[model samples]
Target: MRNVLITGGAGFIGSNLALKLVESGSNVTVLDNLSPQIHGDNPELSPLYRSILGKVKFIKGTVESRQDWNDALVGIDTVVHLAAETGTGQSMYQIKKYSDVNIGGSAILLDLMANEPHNISKMVIASSRSIYGEGKYLCKQHGIVYPNARSAEDMKLADFNVKCPVCSVSVELLATDEESKIHPSSIYGVTKQVQEQMFMITGQSLGIPTVSLRFQNVYGAGQSLSNPYTGILSIFSTRIKNGNDINIFEDGLESRDFIYIDDVVESIMLSIFKDEANYQIFNVGSGVCTDVLTVAETLKNVYQSNSSVSISGNYRVGDIRHNFADLTLIRSKVGFEPKIDFLNGIKKFTTWVNKQEIQKDLYEASIQEMKSKGLYK
Candidate 1:
């Protein structure tokens, strides 16, 4: 991992990763188009892109272009592919954009490495927990089960709990492991699933070490607060800052594994250099489930804001009820464990949010986009 190339290296995770690698004496090169949605209209002036201004060899390009991949791959030994369209609800309509960028871009990178001569020795892809859909659960009669998406009919009646596919009984959430089912409920998740599979297969054929890290809800300082389609922490923070009431989806019991940014970066670092992590898919998370209501309450408390937390019975089509990562595989294989818990992580994130300029609340507009497509009730 001497000379590294990080696709989408100007974003939250990528900028943090690039800084860490540079501190470790690795020559870092970044390839990012600096999308206005994430980086704002003036990308060059955006804090994310400016964070890596002189620290790395930055290339303003997109992964969909083969010439961009060729330019970014020069003399690079390792590739951490983090470029993708990550909005789950938005992906339901923008199927072509997500597929072309996430899957097509990945195909180009692997095709170049497989056919063209390169010094690439290792590859680490950023996979999402969304690939597991409703994730793992335990039922009294079924023992352990992988439930499907909660139905619209059930959700319309305010019954948002995931039921066992085998018995149709309400199931208890379990820590989703690496061997869980691969049925994605959204187009974004499907793209990530394909990206991971393609990388692992091509890497094995090329005789290069490959690792896939199925990251849970990653949030911390430096994340984009302006992006309404993803990153609940950031979205909630933006709403609170604008003095707008925070409206949580569903019954507000939908839980997720919220891992801090530093912990996520550490897991990726371990994967980059560890020999045991080769040809393995590991779950990266804090291993604890935190519900959406708790997140809203904590943010409001931490920010000392008067914004109310409302639990709307409304739900989206591709939303999951609950999912958390089982860290046994990552901990034993890569020796990675999260340091910051939810409370402490939220404190750190809110402190950072306090310093940044308040972003406009676009949550309603985003929801309207989904509602117009009939994906949101």
Candidate 2:
């Protein structure tokens, strides 16, 4: 059995992945700080933490500490590094915190592997689609182009679509391939980009096979319902449950490639098993773009909630208009195909949410924070 260590293993994705690894006969070790944002004030009371209570070796630690890394690396054959601050808007304000944890923590891991002695053979780090800020697009005149960040001037006028860099006309959304430009609009994206690149480069130099999976908007059961800084699905669910209206951002047309949690876990597992996944970056997403309005309406329908859908024409700085994955690379490399479509995925997600207690709606406070920072319009 492979002795695997998963950093941030108490998180939504990490916990789910840990359970699957344990079920597959792998001895799992989890190192997580249990941030109060994701896991309420008392992490021990979190269902996510409790799910893996006695199943895997759990360590309460942060990735920022060198001692913590050393403690978690003992006897580990494979490492899955998933610890990072994930709030895009919040990262703009908390730049130091994101950089310290995401980039600094990753640097520590790679430095230790370069200098220290260990039995780790393979490593997997979670990269983000955010790395491809305003990713690939098809311009009628320019063929394939990568648009620059949408201007706030245009966004204030309610023009949210990404325009062609060459022609300045609106462009068509293309399936962002693995080779797309690596420009990140937010500090969170920048940190993730640096983190993945460090792991890939360091892992290759050390002859330790590393895989970077650029996951797109992962959501489903076990996701933090109280975390208002990220995960619009969870935020919307909480608001709907509380009888509050669903506030849609950017004309409610801004789209994303939402991949289910199970699909994400399956993709990671495939990368672990397949030798071809080494030293490569793959986009893990549903490959279908679903707009914000559709998501809000779907949740309202699924939960049969009385919450109205409100389009406030508000746009956050560093937010993308629309971008989805190509999926050809991941599919060809590790034979990964997403099983759950949005319709079915929503049903499954809502079913799980129905069983849980309604979390406090912290969405307005998060917006106010961003607004005060001048990131929100």
Candidate 3:
């Protein structure tokens, strides 16, 4: 567990994790393609990467390349697989690209683990909350249930709440536990599910310790504001900075669990040394649900922006109604608890965003790209 390799180690979560590992005396190797979506094609390294410069080995490559993986895996005994296409919306139209990078890339890594001789004894794969589409809910009539993804027709009518399948009554969102059913409404979630299943199945055969962390909406200071594909906070911040109104989808009551970067890194660090985390899937999140409207308003207040915030009552396919993690498993298993609350974390993030040079808000343009491909209506 000393010599560690982090795939996609140059991005938001990856970069933060690498810094912690390096600080703790672990030999860290980062394998990243630095996709132009996150970093410009001919761009300087992100400020996060620059902060960790000269401290660890950096490989500019993709996870699918065998040679690059081999080079990155040299003397590495632990692998943290974080590289993947992240946009849930963009994933709808860019099906092949998402599958190739997420599922196919993880397959290559597992194949290397099986066929290649290496010192890999431990592996951690990043899973997503999206797998439990709409998440676990409770009907007043029905005790506990897993609601289905809201239909476009229903969303068209502005019915943004999850309803019981049997009674058709609006259900309440309970904290989704790891035991929740796997019903991903998006292609990205499906790929992540495949990636996690592969790691667990293969790790068992190879007698390697494996951990799958279902990360909630992860955000923090180092997050790339340039990437409009993910990070609602970053996207909103970018738009507000550019004097653009924040577009709220599906009435803005839809909520998600947002965990700070430091908390996420702590969970991974725990998994590395914790035998209890071996061959287990833990939900890593802030354990609190914050609605889209709240998120937009908070960002606006923090920035003191005159940007108008409005909800369209419009929705996207494969989007969930409400979901937050049940931290019971992770806490009981590894004594993991989120330290940063939502307000404090957002303030820290806003402070970081204010320091960085303002960039073009690509929110609408990215949505337009999705619309052109018929992914967004």
Candidate 4:
């Protein structure tokens, strides 16, 4: 049996992975701080944490602690680093918090790898599509070009589409490939970029195989419903749970590639065992773009709630217009393909959400917090 260490193993993606690892007979160890935002004040209050209680070893602490890393690394042969602050809007104002957790936490791992000796054979890091800021677009005059972030002035006029860099004409956002540009629009994105770079660079020099997964909008069961800072679906569902209206931002047409959690876990397992995936960065997405309007409508119908959908002519800073992953590279290299489509995945997610105790919706408060910081407009 292999020894696997999953940092942030209590969160949605990480917890699901931990379950998979435990069932497969791998000796599993979870290292997480159980941030109050995600797990509430008492971590044991979370069903996800309770599920893995008897199956795997658990450690509660921040990754920034060298002592915690030293402890979590004990007898661990494979590592999957998923610990971080994930709020895109909050990352803008809490610059030091995001940097300290994401970048600084990653530095601790690299430092330990450089100094300490262990049996670590491979590592898998959780990266994000955020690094591909305003990713690829087809410009009539410029062929394929990566545009800059959408302007606030354009949003005020309700012109929410991404424009061509050269001709300034509206452009179609295309599926981003692994070789696409690495320009991240948010501070969170920048930190993620640095996080992956440190792992790959340090892992290589230390003779450890590494895989950086650029995951796109992962959602499914066990997603935190109360955390308004992340998981749009969870936020929307919680609002609907409280009989609140659904607020659609940016004309309700901004699109993203949302992959189901099972598919993401499948891709991670593939990277863990495949020799060909070493020293590679792969994009894990459904390879299909689903617009925000479609998602809002779908969730409303599934929940059968009376909440009306509002296409608010509002926008937030550091948000991307549209992005989807070109999963060709990962498919070719690791033979990974998404089995759960958006509609089927939504049904499963809604089924799970219905069983849980309805959380008090904090959608407005989250917006107000961002608005106070000038992040929301």
Candidate 5:
């Protein structure tokens, strides 16, 4: 069995990946600082923690520290780097904190790996669709945008200009390929782009097999039900459970390509074990874009609740009007395809949410606290 190290192994995506690896009989080690917002004092992930508590080694430490990296990398053959400060709007206010963790901390990890005794076989990074910024989509070889709402006849291979209805600003509707331009609107996106560059450059120079998976909106079990700073699904689920209004920042027209946690874990495993994934970048998404309104509607329908959804005119800075992934390369390279559809995924998530007997008021308070701290502004 290959020895694998998963950073941020207590967080939603990381923990899910770790569970899969451990179940497959791989020797897995989880390095997590257990940030309060992500994993601290919460019972949502307790089942995961309990399952692997004795089976896998767990280290509580920040990725920004050199000693943490050294200790985590001792017997690891593959590294799945998933740790990051992911609050997009909050990153605008706390620029230094996001940079220090997402960019600076990632660089340190790469540096530590470069000095390891046995040559590390591979390194996989969890990247974001936010790196494409506001207006773009992922393009297919035929140059068709996969998730475009425009009819087949309306989509033209020739360059086309698209405008955000809210901003009225004209933008090119080009789908970002692996070679697309790196334009980040938020500090979170900027830092993620930097992290991807650092891995690519370090891997090239050090002869380490590195791959980056640009993940779309990932949501599933083990997600912190208490954190309001991120995880829109979790936030909405909590609010609905409390009989409170589901707040939409804008007109609820903003769209995203949501990928399930299981699909994400599979993609990471493919990159770790497959020789074809070396030194490459792939998009992990469902190749379909669903808007916020649709998601909210789906949740409400699933819960069989009449919880009112309030579409507040208030908008967050650095909010993208639309973003989705182009999945052609990832499908061809890693043979990865999202198994769960959005409707089914939502059903599964709702079932899980209903089973949890957590306090609803606490989640609402957390949302208010985030707003008060200017983290969600």
Candidate 6:
């Protein structure tokens, strides 16, 4: 069994990936600070404090610290770096915080991996499509405003460009390929780009195989519903479940390529084991774009419940009008294909949300909870 270290393994994507590695009979070690912001005050995460945790070896620590990296790297053969301060809008205000973890922490990890005794062979990083920024290519094709209707001819070109009309962006913007230019609009995206570069350079210099997987909007079970800074699907589902109004920041026309957690995990696994994916970057997405309004409506339909939705003119700063992923690289490399369609993924997510016992909160409340738990401290 290969010894694998997963940083930020308590968070949604990291945790899901950890679970997958364990089930595949790998010796998985999860290194996490369990920042109350991500894990919450739930006692279940603590070994001495709870009985409901998974079987992987868990270490409570920060990736930003050198000592934590030293402790976690012992006997590790692979590292899947997924930790980041992932708030696009909030990063505008807290640029330093985003850089500290995403860039600084990653730099430290790469440095350690290079000097370590076990000689780490492979590393995979969790990247974001935000690095592409507000796709100018999309703006040129669809105009500043979205088209009222599109035809097969439009779709063919869109298929070539990878644009989305309802969102007023191209699949070229949505389905960003490996060659897509990096133009980060937010501090978060900027840091992710830096993080990717660090791994690429370090891996090449150190003779270690590194891969970066640019993930689309990922949503599934175990995501924190309390934070508006993360997990839109969870936030929407929880709000509708509680008889609260779901807020759409824009006209609900902006589209995103949302990928399920399972598919994302599979992509990571493929990246790790497959020699063909080394020193490469791949976009992990469903290759389809859906608007926010459609997602809200689908949630309402799946739950068989009625909930109000309000579309506000205010939108988050640096928020992409439309973004999706070009799946040509990953599909060709690992034979990766998203099996769960949008409606099916929504149904699964809604069902999971319906079964949860915990109460969900909005943006301000989420921040307040994080502060109260001493996460920021």
Q: Count the backbone clashes (under 3 Å) in each candidate.
A: 0, 0, 0, 0, 1, 12
Error of 5 at 225 (Å): 1.2
- Give the local distance difference test score of model 5: 0.77
CA-RMSD of model 5: 5.9
TM-score of each: 0.99, 0.99, 0.98, 0.99, 0.87, 0.85
Worst 10 residues of 1 by lDDT: 36-45
TM-score of 2: 0.99
On residues 178-218, what C-alpha lDDT tens digit does candidate 4 reach at each position? 99999999999999999999999998898899999999999
* TM-score, cand. 3: 0.98
Task: Report the lDDT tens digits of candidate 3 across residue range 301-358.
Answer: 9899999999887677778888899999999999999999999999999999999989
- Model 1, global lDDT: 0.93
Give the per-residue lDDT digits (tens) of candidate 5, residues 303-366.
Answer: 8888998766445556666767778898898899899988888878888888887634455565
Model 4 spans with C-alpha error above 4 angstroms: none
Q: Rate the local accuracy (lDDT) of all candidates.
A: 0.93, 0.94, 0.89, 0.92, 0.77, 0.76
Using alpha carbons, what is the TM-score of model 6?
0.85
> What's the lDDT for residue 186 in model 4?
99
What candidate 5 gets wrong by more than 4 Å, as runs, is 40-45, 116-118, 135-175, 359-377
lDDT of 5 at 326: 76
Lowest lDDT block of 10, candidate 4: 39-48
Query: If the candidates were sorted by their lDDT against the true structure, best first, what order would they fall in?
Result: 2, 1, 4, 3, 5, 6
The alpha-carbon RMSD values of the candidates against the true structure, listed in the order shown, are 0.8, 0.7, 1.1, 0.8, 5.9, 7.0
